[model samples]
Target: MPDWNLVGKQHVLAAIAECDRLGSRDFLQRYRFGRARASTVWHRGQEYDSKAILGVAYLHATGRAATADDFTRGEAGAVDLLQGLGFDVVVDEEALAAEKAPRVRKTTATKPARASRSAPAAKPRRTTAKSDERVKVCPTCYMALPATGICDNCD
Candidate 1:
């Protein structure tokens, strides 16, 4: 009984079918667009660009986004209208919730020496600014190597 508005005619039909298959009038609700930003809707953790929505619709309808660019603003408007029809669109919130679920696993116990060996070797400890004065002199010409770890003028 909701007021369907901006979506495409075919998109409306598909959302309706999805709603029926999912056994929830709210299925289409998962695809709500904001009043202020008609071009965006939630998808996973990000805002799905309007183009992506068409891409999604294309994928849903034809297994690919072959003609996604063909989805016009009017079509997007039609989709908005269909959402107004009481479809239970998920709006990315559920998707994010599912991702945040706690996962359990076994903990590893390693000897300090073994763990240290597995750990990446600590990067050579950086010397402080005070240490710059103590740079190693080149054996050939006594020229100092800039902290660059190399003597550019020498080799």
Candidate 2:
């Protein structure tokens, strides 16, 4: 079976669980009914937008749509599918954070090698601008001229 990330799987399961709890038939229907009848759904006194809930439901449903692979062959609902197949879907926030954290490479400090006394110190090279280049300037206005050398405001 293919390995799945816990964070993604958890989000899918949460969406499915919410859908089941609300007795929603499908994602589209739920969204339409919520929009037309009730604009929002309250959970634990906190009001959540119906569209947001339906959006999450749709994502979970579509995410588990592909069953051609061996990992999710018989799965239907995101939550039921994983649970029915005996897949341990545990979401550890700390582990997920650790996984997302940038990896730092460890290295031992080394002493710098001394420069050879025989070789003379190299002088820094100075860069000089070429004086032969021609730059057109507007005669009417003392401003830098374009390719046509025509002043926009004066000419």
Task: Give the top-scoring candidate (TM-score).
Answer: 1
Which regions of candidate 1 fall more than 4 Å away from where they truly are?
Answer: 1-38, 43-45, 66-68, 78-155
- Distance from true position, residue 74, model 2, in Å? 32
Query: How well is each residue in 1-155 modelled by candidate 2, as lDDT tens digits?
Result: 32333324344445545555555555334333232132334444444433334335333433322112222322222223344334433333454455446779999999676676555789999885332233344454323344676864568
- The 10 consecutive residues of candidate 2 with the worst lDDT sum are 65-74
lDDT of candidate 2 at residue 97, scale 0 to 100: 53
Highest lDDT scorer? 2
List RMSD in Å for every model shown. Answer: 24.3, 25.1
* lDDT, candidate 1, at 116: 42
